[model samples]
Target: MGKARETILEIDLRALEHNYRYLRSKLGPETKFLGVVKAFAYGSDSKRIALKLQDLGIDYLAVAYVKEGVALRNAGVTKPILVLHPQAVNFDQLIEHCLEPSIYSPRILRAFLKTAKKHRQKDYPVHIKFNTGLNRLGFWENDVSHITEEISGGTELRIHSVFSHLAASEDLNEVDFTQKQIETFDKITTQIDHKLGYRPFRHLLNTSGIINYPEAQYDMVRSGIGLYGFGNEAQIDAELKPVATLKTIISQIHRIEPGESVGYNRAFFSNGYRTTATLPLGHADGIGRQYGHGKTYVEVNGQKAFIIGNVCMDMLMIDITGIDCKEGDEVIVFGKNPNADRFAATADTISYELLTGISQRVNRLFIGD
Candidate 1:
């Protein structure tokens, strides 16, 4: 309820629940829900977030690595978890913890199969990721036959799901590309079904895909940012509530005269007499230097206080001129005043980056049930 640190990321569990319900409202009863708790649950206490979602009865959870999945398991998360990008080295630990992996390449598949066989795993669940267009991960369409053949040899392993990434699902202008991705995923999965003689769970929608292309919602949908209060579109964003608010109090204030400079490298030179506030946040806390030199701002006293000078490792200066604010006043980096989506736009980034960038050292305080 009170801040033990100068800067804190306030997480509203009720807002997160509202977002989950909002997104869930868009899906049918039979459809499954996979809440992505990767990247520290978009940088806001993944264990706590996942625990809440688990209690909410989300069908699955996803993390980017085996370590993250293990963390959830240790935190008492009993729901099925999908490690989106598993490495071969962690296969043993993954299986040890019952963490299913998304095998995208033949090398990974073979390696996992070997590990599973060695462990004498029976019906071990594994998801297959098809490239489809993202080109970041997943197998190509041509890999399906080889995959079916290779996977068929193993009775110990079972294909839990087949999924793909939607490259530009949020960009309506790129609807064609998203459609192509869906089509490719469909074609690849259909071929696999014919060869394997059974259907695995299929999903190919991210937060944006769920909003922009609901028709392509296969057996389930994966949502990361949507759970944290971003819908990738204005209308949809308006319907969701941001769950994390990065707030820091002004540690000190300075009155600079013309010709005086602020911050390291003198990146910001005072044009005239002005007031500035130093915050206990900087690049190390995920507010990169690119946000400096007047590019980004924080909300103070319901006003935009432009960030000035280079963001140091532990501090940044904000021009608080003409604003009624003082030391210890709460300064909103992103949240109620300037929503994370809009705030991130000022830096030519997204809410995901800003939220996940929050330094772990910054304390996190959770509110609501």
Candidate 2:
């Protein structure tokens, strides 16, 4: 490349590994771990993270869609993958990639079974999702009998895992609700396991679940946010490292006069004369327009500079007053000292929202082991 791009995301794979090892340490050897790399590894880079995790010997990998799983497979990841929210249309491709689908509804199960039969796949692996609490995806409790009956009658299909989503595992305040979800999932799994006479891999604990409920950590745990360096529990976060760092370069620097208005809609009117810096990244690059008008900032020479106005489509201006910085100067939007979560905190949001919101146009760079 002629010159390094102004906008880039630095992903720390070492932190990713640290998070994985920390989570893995919490669970017993019997309980396997599945690394969730969906949403481009939570807006980092799934291919890189998945490959690293695979090399580190993660028990399994997971993705939200069939295409996400396919991407991992295309990247030479031979480990088993769970498609968390697989679409009906991609069942064939999922099967082709040797990716397992988490079948929740009877309609989807039937469609996938049909596909397996057409492919002449014997002992085709699948995971059953129960709607213990999330209610977003998974088979309802009432459908347990149907699932068991279907499983018992068929020998071509094999149940690989039975799992449920935690409605709010991170919220300690929702302890009772989370317990109820765990209890409900347990009952469903026991009832189905008894009827079908199959001992499938059982998992319910996510990153939060692993932190708060070691007792509930079943045969395997699926962790998403944990791998990306966020666990709702402060103690857990203390042990985890943030993986994605958002950085940009100053395209230009300018001096503004007192009483001058900046950006569209004149959202920011400076009371004092100040110096400003223009960044080549903006709302289109994942910095929400809401962050404009003094809600966000970039680190300039170890100091924070607030956004001056409404964020534009491709750029934003920051009040770099009193800071010694210029064009080509690096601005740390979120990383290390001034982390992304803290940066997002100014906008009343979380790191997850900001990371997943990172647009594809921004370049991604991976660093360290």
Candidate 3:
């Protein structure tokens, strides 16, 4: 919350707590909450975010890979961690760290069972993933019977929950498709419950799914972007505070005359006298090349300074002709005012890509415990 004297990504833990509490307020008392801390907690520090969520009494945590879960375990995270995409090779390490795996296919299920048995483990919690509509992963509806049959005779693994990914819960235009996916997931769960003669907890909502399709929130809800301060919709965004703010200082200011070019490939030719400010962050720091050429702008001294020319690997220039800013003045790349969603829109991308693309080299400063 202080002025930026150097390039840094400020992580606001209080904002994270606010977002968590806000999302929890939408759920029933019994509904569980799973915080997705994959990709360095959406390009912020995952260990810190996970710890904050843990302190907030989160029911579960999720990561994209086994290594991420192991890292959390190493950092003293004791809450249940679901590895969304556990590989066969790391099944041993996953079990050793007490990380749960989402068994989406027959091959992974079989591999995990073997690994669990080899480790002499019993009743190890594993989630079953159903391919409701997101063709990315998960077993088909017909494969439900196969999953039940395979697990029925084994004690090495236990189906902790059955879950599915919603393809377009954030897009209202895809309501029909999303409803059908929910219906299909319902049928799959019903079949699994019937065949297994018991019920495994079910979950089928992501962040947007929790907001747009609350009816489908079965046993738990998973939130990734929302916890990081984006809600995909303007109204919901207003209720949440962004947890990451990228800030930098003007390294230098330049006065350009007419016909003077700037940056790589002479991307910008000044038509008149203008002033530009260079910041020590660029494509290598996750401000991609597509955001160049005045497509996107950053805030300098509370004024909009459009980016000019191509973004270099470690620096970028912004037009500051009329702005009253100088070297060492704070510049906001994206945060409260513009927010990640609006900033990402200039390049036709989403907040997820921008947030996750931030280079790890950027110094992270935390505010709020």
Candidate 4:
């Protein structure tokens, strides 16, 4: 990819393919791979990313909502899509679009069964979520009997898979807790198999789990951050390549004398002669106000320039003293050199928030099909 002529995000399909293959190398030959393309494919172009993943032969794709899945279908994605947090009201639309839902509660399960029966559908694939420890969403282990009873009552729904979330798979200090969660899930699956008289595919690993606990890769593994080139560990990060690179051009340059202030509320006061360059992106573009006042820095002419003053809604200023930069010069917001993870660390944040926080207003330029 070339340097930015304007504020834009460059996505490399080749990097995405590399990350996918790297993750696959850790899985068993028969284990399935599910690529998560939710949150606009982590703030990149979802339609484009989904298409690439489909062409790459991903076994399944996951989105966080029904509308996201529908968008994929509209974009000609034919692979199975799992809506991780579907609402009961959209059950009809979900069925109409052929998107699977992760049923986590009794009310939602009943609502979906009604919709399936209304459509006169048989064996409609549905994923059951058990709350092993995440506590965010899922049915309790004791709900197995309830779920089995509901399934036995009708044939409108079929448990295609059972899955749970990992609360702290990335934190090695939480190994004991994660193990307990895994053990609990195993027991839940056993009960589910006994009660239902059959076994549905089981999965309980996220991106970190895939790296830290490969032994628990049950039947399939879902990867979101890993697919986007972030493994959540320093050693693993070295093996993956970031897929998105945010870049902008220097909109203008300013010279400030000692005691002069810059930006709103005079947030940055110069103690000596200083030079700064402004860029055409700010809080609204996902570089939030939290990054201002020397909290973070951007690369200007291959040199680190710390952000000064308050980050505006559509503009931000970075001190460029001693740097040989001028108007319209290419500035790397975050990319391979610093990477999103390193850039986000300057503000005490993470790559996921930074990547997904990128606004839609920023133009996206794709490389490598």
lDDT for each candidate structure? 0.91, 0.87, 0.94, 0.94
Cα lDDT of model 3 by residue, 1-369, tens digit: 679888999999999999999999999889999999999999999999999999999999999999999999999999999999989999989988999999989999989998988999988998999998889999999898789888888888788999999999999999999999999998999999999888999999999998998888899999999999999899999999999999999999999999999999999999999999999999999999999999999999899999999999999999999999889999999999778999999999999999999999999999999
Model 2: colliding residue pairs: none
Off by over 4 Å in 3: none
How many times do residue backbones clash in model 1?
Answer: 0
Each prediction's RMSD over C-alphas, in Å, is 1.4, 1.8, 0.8, 0.8
Give the 10-residue window scoring lowest on summed lDDT in candidate 3.
149-158
Q: How accurate is candidate 1 locally (lDDT)?
A: 0.91
Q: For residues 1-369, write the lDDT of model 2, one tens digit per residue.
A: 122357998888888888889999999988888999999999988999999999998999999999999999999999999998998899889888899999989999889888988898888988999888786988898898898777667666898889998989889899999999988988988887887776887999988899998999889998998999888766777888999888888998888888888888988887988888888988889888888888777787789898878999999999988888778988888876667677778889988888899999999887886
Per-residue lDDT of model 1, residues 180-270, tens digit only: 8888888998998999899998999999888888898889999999999999898998999999999899999999999999989888898
Let me know the TM-score candidate 4 reaches against the reference structure. Answer: 0.99
- Each prediction's number of clashing residue pairs: 0, 0, 0, 0
Comparison by lDDT, 2 against 4, better one? 4
Task: For model 4, name the residue pairs that clash.
Answer: none
Report the C-alpha displacement of residue 247, candidate 4, in angstroms: 0.3
Which consecutive 10 residues in model 2 have the weakest lDDT in total?
A: 1-10
